[model samples]
Target chain A: MGTINVSREYSVKEKMFLPAIIQGMIITLKRFIQGFIFHKKYTIMYPEERRNYSQRFRGMHFISVDENKVENCTACFLCETVCPAECIHIVAEERDSASNPYGVRKEKKPLSFDIEVLRCCFCGFCEEACPKDAIKLSRNYELSILSRQEGIYDLNHLKREVKGRG
Target chain B: MSSYEISKSENYLNYCSDKIRPLPVTGPDAKPLPKMTLDGQVVEFVPGDTIMQVAERAKVASRIPRYCYHPGLSIAGTCRMCTVEVEKAPKLMTACSTPATDGMVVRTRSEKVLKSRSGVVDCLLASHPLDCPVCDKAGECELQDYDYEYGPSRSSFVDEKRVFPKSSTRKLSDKIVLNMNRCVACERCVRFTDEVTKTNDLVMLNRGWKKELTVGDEDKGLYNDYQGCLSDFCPVGALTWSDFRFQKRVWFLRGNASICDRCAKGCNIEVHSEKEIIYRFVPIYNPKVNAHWICDEGRLSYKMVTNSHRVIAPLLEVAGHGPTATSWETLIPVTASLLKNSSRALLVLGTDSTMEECENLRKFFSKFVQNGEIRYFNGTGITTSSENKALDHLLRQNDKTPNTKGVESLGLKPLDVAGVNGFDTVILFRSGRAGIPSVAAAKNLILWGVWSDEEVRAQKNVRALLPGLATQEKSGTFMNCDGILQSFKKAVEHRGYGLDVTRIIEKF
Candidate 1:
């Protein structure tokens, strides 16, 4: 294929870039006047204030806890199976009989439940696949991590008190 | 070893349940078999075969569901889930107990039959604890499968369900755990212990709604080699293998065909694994080998591969220190030089090796080493195949290695009874199942194949270690104790830095 360059000579108005610069300055001046005088702001101070996201918005995952602070996850692996990004990993173990007075209802517990937030696509399928309403995606979207290892949320982190999906 | 089709073997014919066998037609006195109509399909069966058997012969056994009707166990006709509508009969007949008559028309999926099965499932579910999340047999449980297929969406019984609190999570044995609340009271385990194993270890304690499963001799406590089989055939989550209790959910696993190498029986097994990590070994229904059972030893043999101390990477000894993990690049040349320098080298092939491996090593050693003598060593009590005996009447054999007969059939001579005495360099090759031979007198020892850290550390003078694949990780044929040649595909990928014998030899 031959190249067809649509190169054209600049007109006098376009060649003189002073008008374009002045137009850009006028728009900036209008925004400055709106913000400085009228006190109209488009963005907030992110550290002090937060935006309101939809209640259904899928963010970081958390395992719901019961009245006694015991995680509701039986580690049925439904979440791990439904995860599209393959980020959810769980190890299941039998709950000790001494601590498990609830009998078959809470007989199994997750020995280790890990979610790699870096790899998670935040699809919220794990929340839907969970039978006991154990794993749910909370509205806490601040997921900054210092290291790659910090991105993996363990059972302890996942079992944090998430009051009504945060 | 002659490769024979597993389906046509005499052991398969013998192992087949006599209650549900096809009529003999080969002999001169053989006559045409009786025929029956099942769900509009005509199927041939022996005279005494049940309606379930006729449907099985026609490959439509799934049309009928029975909690108590295991092919390997005697028919109890207690579940009443296999009810089918026979045209002439006034009431629905249980397919598992009723013998098929010639020219009888049976409708397995009739509305009446469906209602009857739904009723059976509803009754069973009335007392069945909804503990599938904690149940080990959740994915493969027959009750769950039947409930999904033929059960009512909700039960009518609102009364308090029966609960045996003491027996709910009772440990029947070290190998099995019994959850009485989850049982459908199929009594398949009791029947299995009574008929198959003849151990009489388990029994139905009470009668009717309060019927419970408990060890016959509480102190004896399920003392049977085939205790794993009870969990295998249990229709519900009542009896579960303790080893695989909460290890993994069955639906997440992927199964591949393999052979158990813990004994010479060579039971065909389905290696259930996920992401190259094996979770458990369940027996594949091979009538010629392990009909429907695998011993606890073989069922739990995946630990050998997944052992934490297993040496995966190749190792080489430093100046005076013990074997240290090293790359194959540096270890191969060093091993070849050691083999070349030794005046008399002996290669001891562990009888656990497959036929192809033995052949490969025998051919490789003949051309590779100067004065190398290759010999087979089965350090598991018996040195030769002739001395190997059955530990039990069932699957367990006296020979711990899987392929002693196979290695012996290769024309390889057994090592001297005195063990490795005067060899300059001794190469011991195994696949983790074979016992280690005494090498106290050897100057330099080269350990190959699957070895744990303790095995390598126990040796006096170990020069180098070469890691190889376990039985489940590699594809090979085995000559079972019965001289049946069964070839298995690779079940799982080797989760290690181990190399194949052929590749290791090629690299050298």
Candidate 2:
């Protein structure tokens, strides 16, 4: 692979400082007019205004729960299998006989479900692969954290209540 | 390699039922071979042939779907999946139980047959958990394959499905795990336990929608020697072998046909491996041998090959380090010198040794250890062919080693513990099937075959350990219990430091 990048030759007039300076000023003037004259804003006004996302927008993932507050996941591992980034890890165990009212219908339960979101590609494949509507990528895209450890979401973090892909 | 095979018997039962029902041969009394037209192809079949059998003979392009119609098991055509449209017949008939008459036109893939099959799949899937992702049988599940081929786009049942509370995640035996929710009530496992092993360990309780499979005796859960076959024949994710459950997916495995060496039965098996790591051993259909069923001991025998303690590397008895793993270059010259120095060398070939390996050893020793006395050793207690008999009606034999008869046929004497005394250097050669003999009389003992560190440590005055390939890792021929010669190619590459007989001999 030879470098073709060096072959492009700029005309003497365009290479001179004036043309480049004018192009830079034009971008700045357009942005200034849009912000001040038209009152248009590119950045969100945090703590006040929130951006609405489409239903299909893939973002932070959460597991859904049924009316009884029991998780919908039977630990079938479809999400883990379909996850392209290999961010999800799960360990399954049989539900305890004493507490399991659903019986063999919900026999298997994920003992621990962890998702290292940093490694996740936000692909929504897990959402599509899940037989039960348990794992879903929510519309809330604000996934920043203070530390790297917080980016790895556990079952507890995933089980928190979220409404309608939010 | 595919879901249909994992769920179906990899080999159709080749049990020739002719011996059991010996009809009269050529004469006016003898019945002519019946012919049937399956999918427009006419073929001749035996007098009492099922539609599926006729279809097989005709080499029909479309395979009739089946759930409880294992060729190895007695026919219980309850699944309604194999229903086919027979010309002049009013309704669809199950090909499994329906016998084919001469000139019968069977359409396996007609629209009517396909529609009925789709309806059968819907009924079977109504209560099914549809949990294929976590299922060990996902890739090879018969239900999954049939559903993809002929099932309705979605289930119609609106009501909640029935659940067997205690049946899911049930341990039928130490080897088998039963998930009743995944079961489609095919009753194949129940029949297998009843007719095949004759253990009667599994029984189906209740009726209709409330049916459940439970152990015959609650106290004893699946106490059969052939419990591994349940997992092998199950058409769904219901019955799974505990040894292979959740270890690896079925599609990811690479199967190589090999023979089991746990016993003299020489059960043919397919080594299911992924990345050279064996997942499990499933019996391949050999009507002459195992016939689609492998004992749990033979099925679990792959663990021995994959064991961490197996002596893969050549070990030398270092002065301070005990048996230390050393390269062949370092140990080969030393072993050669030991043979040269010893005035009288005795070679003890294990009964488990293949015919070719034994021949190579006999020739190699006669040339190398010129003053050596060669003897074959059968470590599994039984001394001769007269003592070797069937331990069970099935595959197992009294002689545990696979090739006791093979070595005996070589005109080698059995090791008489008292007669073989005061040898200078004794070489114990085996393929890990024979027992380690008490060769205490020998001044120097060289351990060969698949020896572990623990075994080498137990023996005294052992000079070196020449790690050799197990039966699965090498190409050789073993004479089975029935005096049947079985030649097997190397299934998987030798994962450890072990070498075959020829390779080890060349090093000498």
Candidate 3:
């Protein structure tokens, strides 16, 4: 009502530009000095110093067994059929004796099993599709081979690894 | 001066992009342009050419192993033995189905690709019945070779194996046998039925472990004229002919390239024989002609050559008496005397005669016999239907003879059966008595044919019935309806002393 002049009001404080600029520059300088002078590298050489994997880590594969050391697989082709790349191959045989009834006597056994490591995308589909918990991805990823012919994991090789792990 | 300035302006205006430069206009009557090349080799290929196809054209040694990718049939990428390493691709690709691009770098035997292929061979052998000793396709099978090169030393399967019924034991029809145990299921036979024959008679049935092949239950069954193609198309010992099943291993038989003699089609075929006995006939690929198949009738026509019923020697009959076995020397004199003494001599040529024999006979009779009259006769009736008619119609023509058109091509006119007058002497060629009623009516009938049908030989006035050689016993050319001249070699000699018709006529 009194027609107060509200336009362009200016306030002033004591100038401290030099100290504020110095503080910012000091923080930058501290980082630069720490990077060059006092830096102790934390990067680990991968093959020479292996990293600890998580409990659920999936890497190279192995077959699992029950307490009796008998193979847990029923020779069901679920893993082989469900593999998108068709890398998993299993030869199944009947393990049942003539005496048992209820059709339970017929147990499927893996006569010859192989996983083409070269063809594997490591998608964990074979492990996921195994109904008997026979095939599992382990925490070992050293699957390199001198020749391509040696990359195909055969039944004997798989059985030995699985037995050692179990 | 003004024209030069205008041309310069035009050239400046035409320059837009380097890639879009117009090709120089050659004269209209120019010769064919030279083919382009890559890496000092000619680059010639159509669209959808596979890496293997390009490698073949370039004459590059490709190590891709294929079980199902036969050039004669549609591509079935089932067996993964042909894995190849491609530049910039994450995993190895199958060379059979992988298209060749303008600058694609394909490595057939790279370490990664070899590993993948070896893995495939190992996997393929996991469930494969290792019955090579007893398996019919043992020596020739591709799986056996791939395993020898890239497979594991021993099978890991320790349990009682899954046993499928052997296809050799299962009879699908009178013509086909199915041995399921040895099938790699490359689907070549299935693809052949679906693509080339278009009959859809065979089908892959069941799923997963229980998969098998079956034919329809219709009365015709797998009785398509191209049924023998399945046996040839089978890479494994799955589909075999009942006629050839357990008879002889394929390795035992030596294959000779021959043409089918069942019809005027003259389909290219391979005659598999041993000890001069033809055991089987399979089709050979001729793109301009029979693509990859021949009629079942043509396949079985080999039997006619080796059948025990075939006449093995020349037989001569005394006047009005039953035929007596005679030497060629005795028959030659009888035939020459009959031709020379008769007032009117008639030479009735059969359709099975080769072009050489027909032409030679025409000339021989012209010199020796009076008036030298000759007529064409065959067991199958001639029809006016076009040669390119539907397959069913063509098969029903009943023209069992192979060289009707060959004889026709040799300038022999079809005899007007209705206008034939009685002749004093007649010499019959190789056909049985099916087409000629007038020839039988002739006075002195000197029958020089393979064998007499019971009715024709019993006719009165027949003087001499001589058994001549069948088609297999002679080598000559047959010009098919399409004018393709196919030459067939003599498969074997007749058991007795019967001279080839060409030689007999030449001697006369």
Q: What is the lDDT of residue B346 in candidate 2?
A: 91
Candidate 1 residue-wise lDDT, B1-508, digit = tens: 4664322232332233754465566788877887888888888787888888777766677778888888888889988888999998999999999998889999999999899889989999998878787788989999999999999999989989899989988998899999999888888888898888889999888798989888999788889988888888888889999998899889989988788999999988888898989999877777667877899899989999899999999999997777988999999999999999999999999988989899898889989898889888888888898998998777899999999988888888999876777788999999998889889899999999999999999997999999999999887888988899988778889878898899999988
Residue-level lDDT tens digits of model 2 in B433-506: 78878877788889888887678888878899899988888878877777778888778888888888898899
Return the TM-score for candidate 3, rounded to 2 decimals. Answer: 0.65
The 10-residue segment with the lowest total lDDT in model 2 chain B = B1-10
Which residue runs does candidate 2 get wrong by more than 4 Å?
A1-122, A132-166, B1-32, B219-221
Candidate 1 CAPRI classification by DockQ: medium
Give the TM-score of candidate 1 (chain A): 0.83
RMSD of each: 3.1, 5.1, 29.1
DockQ per candidate: 0.66, 0.25, 0.01
In model 3, which regions exceed 4 Å deviation? A1-166, B1-44, B58-63, B165-168, B217-220, B319-321, B383-390, B393-398, B431-438, B452-462, B465-469, B491-495
Task: Give per-residue CA lDDT, model 2, range A1-166, as digits (tens).
Answer: 6766557777998779898899899999999999999999899987598887677889888999887888888777778877889999887766776898876567668888999999999988999988888999988788989999998899889985678868
Better of 1 and 3 by TM-score: 1
Ranking by TM-score: 1, 2, 3
For candidate 1, the lDDT comes to 0.87
Q: What is the TM-score of each candidate against the true structure?
A: 0.93, 0.83, 0.65
Please list the residue runs of candidate 1 whose C-alpha ends up more than 4 Å from where it truly belongs after superposition: A1-29, A44-53, A145-147, B4-22, B25-30
* Overall lDDT per candidate, in order of appearance: 0.87, 0.82, 0.65
Q: Sorted on DockQ, highest at the top, how do the candidates line up?
A: 1, 2, 3
